[model samples]
Target: MADIAHTVHVALGDRAYDILIGDSLLDDAGAILAERFPGRRYGIITDDNVARAQLPRLLKSLDAAGLGHTEIVLPAGEATKSWAYLGQAVEGILAARLERGDLVIALGGGVIGDLAGFAAAIARRGMDFVQMPTSLLAQVDSSVGGKTGINSPHGKNLIGAFHQPRLVLADLSTLDTLDARQFASGYAEVVKYGLIDDEDFFFWLEEHQAEIFAGGPARGEAIARCCAHKARVVIEDEKELGVRALLNLGHTFGHALEKDTGYSDRLLHGEGVAIGMVLAHGFSARLGLAPSQDSGRIAQHLKKSGLPTTLADIPGKLGSTETLMAAIAQDKKVSRGALTFILTRGIGQAFIEKNVDGAAVAEFLNEMRALPLSP
Candidate 1:
C-alpha cells in the first residue's frame, strides 16, 4: 500500500462519514472496516465481473479482520438494478442471518453499490453498508453519497433511498483493471467538478491530462478533489432539496440519453454524461447564461480525454430533438410543470434556473445536431 492518504469529510450530522482514498486501499480494508464497523458478520454484494478480478483481495482483508462474511455475486451491468434482483439480495442478507447492526459491503462499481445499498436500506428497515467502489466513476461519485436504490422502467434510480454508507473505501488501485473506455468514462465526472465550480481545477485537468490519464499521483489527487466536492454538496443537502441539485450538472441530460439508448452496453453512464455536459454547456451558451467559448473548451477537453462530446458519437441513439425533449420532460428534476436545468456561466460557476422554456431547449438540441463534431 502506498503512503498516500486522502480523506474527505461529509458533514451530515449523525449520518456523516469519511471518504478515504489511497493506493492499495483494498489491502487496508481490514483495518478500515474494523475501525468503521466493529460488528461480527458482514454481507458482501458484488457482481461476477468484479468478483473475478477484485473480490479475492477484499475477502482476504475481511478474513484478516476476523469478520465473518458471506459473498453474493450478481450479474454485471445496468440490468441487475431490478426489483427482482433487489429482493434476492435482501433475501440473501436474511438467509445469512444479518442483523441491522451488521454491515453490508458493496464491492463493485455503481451497479453493485446501488443494488447492495438499496438492499441494505430496506433490509430490516435499514442495515449499515460500506461502499468499496472499484470503478473510477463509482469512486469519485456514487460511493460517497448514500443515494442507494434500484432502477425501474420509469427511470434510473427512481426506486431508491438516501442510505449513506458507514464508510467509503476508494481504492485507486482498482482502476488499473479498467479498460480505456471505462477509464475515459469515469474522467467525464471528474471533469464535472470543474464545470460546476472549480475553474482552476478545470484548467489544471486540461494541463495535466496526460498524467491524469496515465494513472499517477496527479490522477489520485484529482479523484480525491472531486470526491471532496461531492461530499461537501451531499453533506449540505442530504437529499435533492437545494445545493445538492447542483451536483446533477450533467445528469439531467445524461439520464435522458441513457434511457433513449435503452441503457445498453453501447453507451456507458460516463459516456452519456460526457456528451450531456457538452450539451448542457451549449444550452447555457444558447440562453446567454454562459460563454460559448467555455462550452467549446469543455467539449475539446472531453475529446482529448477520449470521451464522446457529441450526440452522434452515441450510435443508434435518439437524435431527434423531439425525442430528447420528451425524455427531458420525464427527468426527475422537473417540478410542477416547469423545467429546471443546472446551467453554468463559466467553468466553476453553475446555478439552477427554473421555469426554463422547453421549446428553447429543443431548439438548442436541434442546433447541436447540425453543428460539426466538436474537436
Candidate 2:
C-alpha cells in the first residue's frame, strides 16, 4: 500500500465528490468518512466474494473509528445484480432503518456497486451513498461513474439510475487479491481511457504492461490515471448527454455479447469490453474510419494480455449475426431508432457517430461473426 494517496474531484457544484485513490486507502477509510459524513451509520451492501476479500479491512477501519454500520451481503457475481436481489437489498436497507440523510457503502465490484448504488437511489427516495469499490473494474470505471443498474431480460443495464455517490474510495491494494483473469478484465477499462482520448496513455500501457500487472507503484499509478480520466469525463458531462458518451467507446458492442452470454463468468464484463474494443476498431476500419492495421494493433495488444479480442474467442454460443444486431438495436445509445456508436478515426480519436446505418452495422456484425477466432 502506498503511503500517501491521490485525490480526483468530480466537480458537480453541490453534487461534487472526490475519488480517493492509491494503496492503503481502506486503512484511512475511517478517518476520511468520519470527517466527511459525520455521525452517520452506514448500511454496507456487499457480495459474498467481496466480503471475504475486502470486508475485514473496511470493518477494521470502521471499528477503529467507532463508526456503526449495518450490512447486506448478497451472493457474488453478475447474478447478484438482478431485480430479485435488488428488491432484497432495498428491503434490507430499509430494515436497517436508514433515512434520506444516511448513507450506503457499496463494497464490491461492479455488481455490488450497481446493485447497491441503485438501491441507494430508490430507497427512501434516494439516500446519499459512498463507493468503496473492491475490484479493478470498479476502481477504474463502474465505481466512479454512478451509473447504477441491473441487467434486464432484453439487454444489459437496461434498468438503472444516474444517482451519483457522495464519494468514491478505491483502495488499489485490493487488486492484489484479484485472480489473474479479473485483473486482466479490469485492465481493459484502463486501456479504454487511452483508446478513447489519450494515445500516449495507450502507448505507455503497451510499454509497461508488465509493471501494470505486477502489484506495485505502477499499479497504483495506472489505477489513479484511469480514475483521473473518468473523473474528468464525469465532471464535463455528469449525464451521458454530451462528451460522457465517449466513455462507452466499446460498450455498445460489448453489452450485446454480455447479454448473449447471459452475463456470467463465461464472458466477464471487461472480457466483453476487450472483445468489443477490438470489434469497435474493426468496425471503424470497416466504415473507413480507421486503418485496418490500427485495428489489428489493438487486437494484438489485447490478445497478448490474455484477453479475448473476437466474437469467436467467446466461450459459448453468441447466437447469430442477426441476433447480435437485434441486441445492438436495444443499445441505450440509440436515438430515434438510429444507432449511435463511438467509432474512432484511430486510437485516441474516438467520436460519437449518430444515425450510423443499421444495415452497415449488421454487415459489420456478419463479418465479425464470420472471422475465425484469434489465438
Candidate 3:
C-alpha cells in the first residue's frame, strides 16, 4: 500500500493524471503501475545520482511484481538537460524497443524529469511517461507541471514541449538522501507557491520551515499543498496561456542567472530562484508597486532557510547587466520581442507584466550589484 498520504488529481480531461505523495511509494510502484497500466513495459530514465541512491528500490519493486523494464542513467545536474542528453534519452528508449503504448518513467529530480519527459514527447512521435520525482524541487514544482523540456545555450528551457505524464509518484523517503544544501535549494520552490498567490500558505511555511527540514509531518502536508495549488493552476491554464504564468514568479531573473552561471553548482536552479524572488519583490518595491519591507521579509525567510537571496550571494564573478538582459530577451515568456515578467505587488500578488521597461530592469540590476548587504 505504500502509505499513500496525499493524491492530487490534475483534471485535464483525457490527459489527466494523479500526483501521489506519500512514504515509500517507490517500493510499491510496481504494484501500482501493474494495476493501473496493465501489460505495458516501462523505460526508467534516471540520472547518475538517483541511480546510485534510489534505483535499486524501484528495480526491486518492479522485479517483485514481475514487471519488465529498462534503465537509462544519464549524468546528473542542469547541463544534462541539453540536446546531446535529450538524444541519448530518446535513443535509449528506441533501442530498448519501447513502443508508444509503453511508459517512460522519469525517476529523478527536475533534470531527469525534464529530459526524460521531453524524450518521451518526441520518441516515436510522443510516448506516454510517468514522473517519479525524487528531489523536493521536482516533486513540488517541475514534476506536477508537465512543462517538459531541455535548456539551450541562449537561455533556460528554450527547447521543450508540454507533455503531461500519465502519473506522478513523489515518495517522501527519497528526500532523506538529499544533503542540507540540496534540500534547502528545493525549499526555495516550496516558498514560491506562497509568493505566487497564497499568502496564507506562505505564512504556514514560515511557521513550519524547521519542521519541513526536519522531515516532520508538516513536510508531507506542505508538498501536498503545493501540488494541489499547482494542479489547480495547471487545470485553468495547461499551457501557461494565462494564470499559469504566475507559477514563474522568480523564473525570469532566475533563468538569466542560471545562464550566467553556466548552470554550475555555483548557483543551483533554486538558489537562483531564491535570489530572483528577492529581486522580483525588490524590483516591485523600487517601482512603487510593492512595499520594500515585503522584500526584506521574504529575503530574511529565504536566507534563514540557507538560500542565497541576493545577487552578491553568488560566488565569483557575474555577467554584466547587458549580458543578463540578453538572456532575459531569450526567455520563453518573451512575446513579439517584448519582455514579459512575473512582477508582484506584494507577497502572493504576482501578475504577468508584458510591457516592462528594459531600461528600468537594466538599471535595477546595476544598482542591485552595488547595493550593500542588508543588516
Candidate 4:
C-alpha cells in the first residue's frame, strides 16, 4: 500500500495530539505508539469481528516494537457497550497488570474505543490509551475526540467520560471489510463535518460521492478531513462547554430516536444521525430560519449515500408526538426546562437555539412524519 501523507493538529492546551491519516497507518502504529508511550506495557481491547480481521496485523506491529501486550476480545455491536462488558474490559486490563502509565489500545470501531477508553479513564484515575479505529464512523468521529463512555439503560453514551487517547491510528484499509450499510452509515458523519462548518467540503463530498463510496483514496481523504474538523472542535473545547456543541448537530434528535426505538441494530448511530440531520434542517425550515430547499437537498444527499433520511426509515412505528417530545425533553442538551436544539440555517452553518418551544417542536415532528418520501 502506498503511503498517503496527511496530518491534522489538535490543539488542546498542553495535552494536544495530531491525527495522522494514510493508507498503511496500521503498519506504522508500532513507531507511533512507541513514541507516545515508550516502555509502557499495552493492553488491547477489541470486538470479535475486528479481532478476526485486523488484530493479527496490529499484533505483529506491537510485537515488532517489542511492547508487552495482551488482548481482550468482546462481543461486537452496541450491546457490548454496557456496564458488564465495561467491567470485563477493566478486569482484563487489570489481569494483565497494566498500570497507570501503561496504555490501552482500542482496536475496533466506536464500541471498543468507547469501552476501552472509558475504562482507561477510570482505571487508575486516568491512564493513557490509543485509538486504532477500523470503522469509518470511528475514524471520522469517535476516535478523534476523547469523549468515551458506556451506555445506560436510559440512553446511548449516557455513561462515559472525557478520556483522550495518546494517539489515534485510523487505518483506511480496514474499511475495505466494512459492509455496505456500515460504510454508508459512517459516511453520514463524514457529511456532518461539512454540514456544520465547511460548506466547500460538503460540496466536495457531493462531487466525489461515487469514489468515496467505492472506497478509493478519496474515502481516506474524506475521513481525514472529518477527523480534522472534529479534532479542532474537541481541542478548543475538550469538555464540550461551548463550541463542541456544534458537533452534536444531529445527535440530539438522533439519540432521542435511538432511545425511542430501543437502540436496536435496526438503527445504527450514523443512520439515525442521517435522518436526524434532515429533520433538524426541516425543523429550521419550519421555524422560517432556513430554506426548505436546503433541507430537501440534505435529505436527498443522505438518501443517495444509502443512508436513512426520514422518520420512515426509523424501525418502530411512528408513535404519538408526545412520545418523541418526551424523549427530547430528557435530552442532555436541554437545560433549565428549555429544549435546546441544534438548528442549521444552511449547509456549513449550525446554531444552538434554547428558546425553541416544545409544543412547536412536537407539532413540527408530527408534520414531518406526514410528509411523503421524495420521488
Which of the numbered candidates is closest to the native, going by highest TM-score? 3
Backbone clashes, candidate 2: 0
Q: For candidate 1, lDDT tens digit of each residue in 260-301?
A: 888887789999899889888888888888888987889889
> TM-score, each model?
0.97, 0.97, 0.99, 0.96
- Best-fitting candidate, measured by lDDT? 3
Candidate with more favorable, higher lDDT: 3 or 4: 3
lDDT of 4 by residue, 111-221 (tens): 889999998998878888888899989999998879899888767787889988877878888999999999898899999989998999999999999999887878878
Clashing pairs in 2: none
After superposition, the stretches of candidate 3 with alpha carbons farther than 4 Å from their true spots are: 373-375
lDDT of 3 by residue, 1-375 (tens): 668999999999999999999999999999999999999999999999999999999999999998999999999988899999999999999999999899999999999999999999999999999999999999999999789999887788889999999999999999999999999999999999999999999999999999999999999999999999999999999998899988888989999999998999999999999999999999999999998899989999999999998888888899999999999888888989788899999999999998999999999999999976544
State how far residue 62 of model 2 sits from its true place (Å).
0.6
lDDT against the true structure, per candidate, is 0.87, 0.88, 0.93, 0.86
Q: lDDT of model 3 at residue 145?
A: 75
lDDT of 1: 0.87
Quantify how close model 2 is to the true structure by its C-alpha RMSD in Å: 1.4
The lowest-lDDT stretch of 10 consecutive residues in candidate 1 is: 366-375
